[model samples]
Target chain A: MTTQEDIRSTTADRHGFSEVGPDDTEAYVELQQSLAFTRLRSRSRRYLVSMAALFLAVFAGIVALMSWTSEPQGGSSVAGIDLTLVLAAGLLVLPCVVTVIHLVYTRRRLDPLAEIVRAQFERSRR
Target chain B: MIFSLIILLVVSRLGRARDTCSDFYVGDRTFTSRQNGLALFGTFTMMTSFVSLSDQIAWHGRRGVLLAAGFAVSWLVTLLLVAEPLRNTGRYTLGDALSLRMRARPVRMAAGTVTLVVSFLYMTIQLVAASNLLALLLGLDGAAARPLIILTIAGLTATTVYYTGMRGTTWTQIINAALLLTAVLVLAGALLVYYRFDVARLFGEAVGGATTSGRDLSGPAPTGHRSPQPLEMSSQVLTVMVGHAVLPYLFIRFLTVPGTRDVRRSVSWAIWLITPYYLLIVLIGFGAAALVRPGGLLASPDQHSPVVALLAVELGGVPMRMFVASVVFTTIVAVTAGLALVTAASFTRDIQLNLTDRRDGGERHEVSVARRAVVVICLLLAGVAILFVDANLTFLMSLDVTMAASSIFPALLFAWFWRRFNTVGALCCLYGGVAVTLALVTFSPAVSGDPLALFPGADFAYLPWRHVGLVSIPASFLLGYLGAVVSSERNDAKYAVMQVRALTGIGAAEAVTTSPALAAADGEPGAPRSRRWLPRQRRQH
Candidate 1:
């Protein structure tokens, strides 16, 4: 087991904190948070089920496309491949627009995760 | 310890090794959003997709690239949910999240092990690609493939880890990104010029004329390499293309950028970057399709693919040949660098954090261990590449992609979005998906049949008719989610809350400047030193 100093004490600063001392208390939080990223206790079944369902749904669609097309038989474009090229060429003028739109929608959902970390960090700092 | 390595590596590198270890591997938090966008553009030319997508287009007509488009969508998925959250939640490595959130050392170890193993397989593809290109260029016996690849690229990778570390890798990738763009434009432009600018007409002609055996071309076939049908998917094809393409090496590449927004932008830009490159590959494939007709073909056009041979005829000179060779070489090198760095970082960060996170005082050991871990991981990749250089590209990419799609992608997605996701679920789903897929692939009639059998009949199809992806991709996700539910009984709400905060970008990191030589717990634990590295205090909370 590592003793108190390796992690318990704050790491030395290169140009020593200009106007700051190593916050020993803040230092303790780092030790805890570092573990926070690495530890994996377990998961809830419901979540796993949901992920499975989503994977299945998308996969089934891929299969449906495969079977529905009925072999790589003809000179037909499967999976909307023809359309993909069309869209890709258009994006040359505007690379990030579509992805940006989707990212914004998801950002709201993810932003709250950050809030939780701040709240925990603040409380622990006390 | 990494900072020390960076100091040593500045010479061989084209750029400064000024970035911190995390910055070198994951990019400095300061990596511009624009650069991140370009970085994605450069790196996402995944190995699995290269041949599968190209062959699909050759056989299935233009719709083949739909698979490519499907794979590309993941980058967008990354931009929206994963880019910022993954960047925000952790400082280094996938193991960081596992250890930090669960406080489980074993879990971090398990994740790190998977990362290293998967990377080893993925890296082999790049090494083999380099070897093949060199063999083609040098006019050497194809049998010399393994030695050439090991001597050149392996030596480079080992030295990279020893010297430039992550900084060297990033700069190399950046240069490749630039060269790849120019190469793509050049080849695409040349093809378009030859076709008189009507790509659609060329496609229509290729599709209209495509035959089962694309054997009508004039070029000499490489000896001992012939299959009856051009469109056939042998068992080897299924394994390489589907399995190898989606592996973690590519997925992990996104983290090389500095920040979330940059990653987001990079993801978006990646689509633009790779889209044309692949689309141009179609033009190249169609050129082969057009030039190499059935019945008169000397070799299946896919083998020669006419990209290189045609360049000689079209440009009619040495400059063009050199350019073509350089472009192909760069593609291999760029990809190799990306794969090697991903492996190195995963080995370093994952093992370092796992050993130290549980123990309160393990920072220095963690750093030392991470460096040593990189050495071991790169060597392992070199060994695997040496053994498997002759395996068909289609088989290699298939196995790599399918496993990645089934396992790593699901884990990362759920880890980011699925709140209830737990380790048991992730493990079960990933292993189940991969196992079932591999078994089906084993009995794939096309692959199991003798290469020169008179009848070529199979006992049973075993696989569900076609592309094993249809089954395994979903199976993996199901197992992961279900595994989570089973493990939910050991619910750790506080841990979930912490994860949620991290994903939301509200997490804060205590700025660490330099680690002391030895801590106070030691006989003479040095007092904490200067703290110039801390970010200015802000009300982020």
Candidate 2:
């Protein structure tokens, strides 16, 4: 039931970014405009897009490969099993592979940048 | 079974003393990452994932395997896109996060309505699946026995959600998830041991059996010799992968943890658990095909789900059957409780509270209404399950996921990331996405035309594809953009605050700590804000 102004004031007071002081609008704008956050945001955005594309590619590739070879009997066999089953097996493992890669990238690249952003926010408050 | 029921009741009883809204909705936000992770695991891996999936694989071959993989892929979607940012923004539900930037009441009403619809559909699906599986387990085939079993399940789900709320539901899910995982591992291990740890042989046997049995081998149809069109398969996969990330029950789990790190940790835990779980499911499905007789495994169309039961009988005997059945029953109850809890939460916290103008003792009133909502929702679920006891509901499950993906997923993404997204845009995304999906589903092969569709007698299906997600998902994102562009409302300042809070979790804790309801319930109306809300261990690091 709070008015728009009340909400804005509350938000500002809660965040209390040091440089922005009591200015609610500037607090968020300033933080977003900071160099560390901008870098982190861009890096995170790139990572997200790439990982998503990679997952879609692998997923689509498996589905396409399976469909292209859907023969009357079994499509083809690797050793004793059908090629469709082998690729489907690959589909089962696809998420695990993608998740591991995501975690590694997040930890190695994104996490450090996020830390920098946090430290910058803290330092500015002082 | 009786013993586990007693334990669940005890946990719920202990939680009943704290009847605050926060406690009811999210266990007062006190669960550790591991606990919430297990709950998330249980919530996502429902009866369909455990029984129906492997059954589909056993009977349908590659199609089933693809579906199972799609389920696991969903966890990855949640991990990458949803968990952390949502955890930072939302206090209880998806509506809370959306309401931060837009007009609160209308957004909540829309989100709550969708949440209720999806939850109801999913709950009914779970209830029917559970009753059927339990009937198969107990060797009960009569119509009379099914209604009885449905009632029992509904009763158990209602008890768990009504008495314990989230606290009780979390504990129940944690227990069931562990047991379900153990059951799958044992079943898979038995299969592996039987094959002398040679997976190639298992696959070989499965392929050989399917060919010799003269079945489709690569598609869902039992008699047809065609693979699903690539578009059809891709659409189904996309439906599950995109849709699952926004399922209200699963999405709400992101809000239960205390902080961002915990959110990431928990989703990570869920992904790790689910990955191996799906891998094992693929094995078990093949094992069922390889080991169980085709006549026994595919006796009736309704008997597709008992592949696991048949496999257990083949592996051990009656004792193994009973053990697997118990695990399935517990899994069903745990997942049902989660659905009920979320449904109730959406009703009271999002719909009712927003629609009304009352602010006095709203927290207590909300908790009261939520409890009643659990009872009402469970009763309705039981009734719908009875009505659809004989119908094929596998389509309904897909529809629920598609609905969530089309509606909530687009709205949440745009709201959190797109600064231009306003109330009008969000409303358009939410309602428009839902409308488009439902319209497509109405005309899709899943509802008619196809022999296995919901209405096989009708032939009005215009949409070639079965799943609506392929079209509706992109349409929703487009609608969001178009809606925003059409509206003059802009909230760059609010978006600034939301972006900062979502990315950094800077002011996120205040949403919880300064909750008017929580403050009143705790008798701390003027409680000073503190950094104690931060994860102490994570902060130290």
lDDT agreement with native, every candidate: 0.49, 0.77
Q: Could you give me the TM-score of model 2 versus the true structure?
A: 0.89
TM-score winner among the candidates? 2
TM-score between candidate 1 and the true structure: 0.70
Interface RMSD of 2: 5.6
Docking category of candidate 1: incorrect
lDDT per residue for candidate 2 within B1-541, as digits (tens), equals 6745664655644546256766788876666677788889988887777888888888878778888878888887888888888987786787778877777777888989999999899888888878888888889889788889888878888887787787678877887889889999999999999999988888778867876777665654445322356677778888888898889888777777677777787888888788789889988988998898777766756633678898999998998989988887888888888889898888887787776655576577778888999999889888988998998887787888898999999998988788788988898889999899999999988888887889989989887777778899999999989988999877566777678767777655422343665444433233223333363221110
**Candidate 2 segments whose C-alpha is farther than 4 A from its true place:** A1-25, A69-83, A115-126, B3-6, B9-13, B218-227, B510-541
Off by over 4 Å in 1: A1-97, A103-126, B1-24, B46-52, B142-146, B208-247, B291-318, B349-368, B445-447, B450-461, B508-541
Q: Write the per-residue lDDT of candidate 1 for residues B1-541, one digit (tens) a residue.
A: 1222332243253233333554345433433445555655556653334433454555444344444444544454454445555655555566654444333444456666676666666677667765665555444675665576565666655565445455455544555577666755675677678779877666555544564454211111112233322223222233333343334554555554444445555666666676567667666656545644543233433342333434344543555655555555555555666666666666655555445444343444444454566567667767777776656544544555666666666666666555576667656655666676677556654354533221245545454333466567667788887878877423333234435434433343332332333222212122223232222333321
Best by DockQ: 2
**Tell me, what's the RMSD of every candidate?**
10.0, 5.5
**Model 2 chain B worst lDDT run, 10 consecutive residues:** B532-541
